[model samples]
Target: MVKSVAAPQAKGKSAEDKIFGANNRAVALSEKLGADKVINGTVGSMLDEDGNLIMLDVVQKAYKALTPKEIVAYAPIQGYPDYLEAAIDQCFGESRPEGYIRACATSGGSGVLHHVIHNYSEWGDEVLTSDWHWGAYGSMCNDNGRKLREFELLTPDGHFNMESFKANVSDMVAKQYNTVIIMNSPANNPTGYGLSDSEWDEVLAFLKDVVKGKDKNIIFVSDVAYLDYSGEKHECRKFFKKFGNMPDNVLIVVAYTCSKGFTMYGQRMGAMICVTPNKDIADEFVAINQYTSRATWSNSNSAAMKVMANICKDPAKVAELDAERAKYFHLIQERADLFMKEADECGLKYLRYISGFFITIPMEGSQKVCDELEKENIFLVPLGKGIRLAVCSVSKKKIHGLAAKIKSTLDAVGAKQ
Candidate 1:
């Protein structure tokens, strides 16, 4: 027998991350067959029309302008005072909710998820999210000794399934009394669906009713990593105003990231902000999350924090950044439009794609479909229920004829959509 010293929980842990696996395969094929003949859509990062990664010019300039000290120094465990305010401002925009708000730096949007899971939930507790969610949510919960429960994201008619959501929340609250829900919207990963303003109202109203007389705590985490690329700037954020005046037991945590918005992917800069009707809760959010930061990552990237602080402080810089991002936004939109149009014509079934980096095709045998597509030099992420196409990285040229090919593959495999 082999000797081992790993803890039970840590033993036999290996990551076979399908996303990276697919990307690696695509790269190997590209090297053999040449890049021009391959359609690589595995990663969720913006790419130019020529298949080169896009880093916003304005953000690049800002980083290049940073002093050596700014790049090398350690940021505060919580964050710089100005960067915290900038995070709140960037997250809320004009739809600032009426609440006692506070923020702390994080590694990225993923770090925000980690801190929320650690701080808001009890060990062995069940956390809630939509069924068609980013896969990392499950990993994070499992790593922290929490179970993840999911509600159906869409009804058969392609609308938000409030019934499923309410039922799931009720079940979770009954079991744990303290429920933590993570909602990724405005550009949900794997699927581009976003809840409407009315849907937002319904969700908040239902939650308000759930905790009416019961002594319960609800922590709602809005993972807005793709908010900047979702749609019209202020229009996409209008739902945030509804967070105001929420029940004291209902706390709102906004996970904001500069990855997509500022094209700062590798910089690993983001913040987790709390909004509460009670000032005490807001203060406690800062204290606890800051302490968690120290215990975990220690601090975030100082240069990235300073870049955001500088950008947020100047109106001109903000305008320039927005303008530059809009160009790529429209570029991605055009690519999505091309694929969606072709999908419609070819009878390709996909999740309701409003706007975002990825579009998921709901199917029974996604891994098989993706495997077949890979043979044709087309690589995509295979989720449990479907294949995710990263329109953010695929240019319009490559997007052409892509949906029809996928539909044909599904048909060949007799996969149900």
Candidate 2:
């Protein structure tokens, strides 16, 4: 073989995003057979009843009104001042926890993940998250020269598995003095699961105990990328208050993104909001993440930042945006509900789903089932242990009977449930 030129660490890297691969196949089939005949459930974004991408009306208008300077000018490495403030205000909503909070704009929620994995963990250290997590978490950890360890996400009765969580976390903290723990919640990806206030309390209490006598640091990251579509605004955010007055060693970072919430997927606007009782740590958060931002993407999208700032600063615009988002939120929820109801009636098992865009069905030979489903023009993402159906992209009419179809597909493939 010819001598490789890439750095040793980068040599064997290949792009194998199965989700996008499956989507490409779905799109091709849609073109061949027409859109109505193909059930394309491989998308990660929201699609309307007619299968068109849904962009918020308010967001579109704000973008249209932006001046050329606003659209083209570079944003501060730390993001525009107003945008940072608005990000914090919007992220916390009524559940603004008491802490020395700070925000730094990132390229997107993915950028926040990149920064946290790079800055918080040591090389070769294991970053902790749930077993049934967004696949990108593992990819990020691998890219950052760290390992990703997972705790069992759910128990036998379909609840948060606290025992497994504590056990795995204790092991990681014992091995590595500092551990970065990522909890994607208020609508976790793939499973559509959100922890309740009581569940949050259990997690915090466990972390508090883990650091009782050790020189340890726990960087808790909340990936709230789907928070807007999860539930009622304030009601869904109540668990945020649990972050208040944490041990100085336990730092909470909320990775807030406008991709799903504001329908600004292409804009790549997001922020990393840190909550800590220590002012010094909060200040250090901004200093370090901004430096990373400069080294990474240099700066975020200025037009998206300005649009958010302008909309957030005006109450009327905020109201309009909220109403528009709520409309789509309900639409997504209705689609989720329809599939869930059918799943329940058909005795199809799924992970505990509270609110979010996707729902996962646990099974063996998931890839086989997904491939078989594709033969029927029904496209879904196959996870390691389950099939992730994008309820966000499927319309209510199409969502109906989907559970039954999947159940039959699972049986046809001889995939164990």
- List, residue by residue over 162-227, the lDDT tens digit for candidate 2: 999999999888888788999999788889888878889999998988987778999999999999
- Stretches of model 1 off by over 4 angstroms after superposition: 1-3
For all candidates in order, the CA lDDT equals: 0.91, 0.91
Could you give candidate 1's per-residue lDDT for residues 1-417 as a string of tens digits?
667798998777668888888998888888988988999999889989988889888788888889999889987899999999999999999999998989999999999999999999999999999999999999999999999999999998788999999999988888786899999998999788899999999999998888888889899999999999988888998999999999899999999999989989988999998889998999899999999999998988999999999888999999998898778878888999899899999999888888889999889999899989988999999898999999999989999999999999999988889
Per-prediction tally of clashes: 0, 0
lDDT of 2 at 78: 97
TM-score of 2: 0.98
- The residue ranges of model 2 lying beyond 4 angstroms of the native Cα positions read 1-3
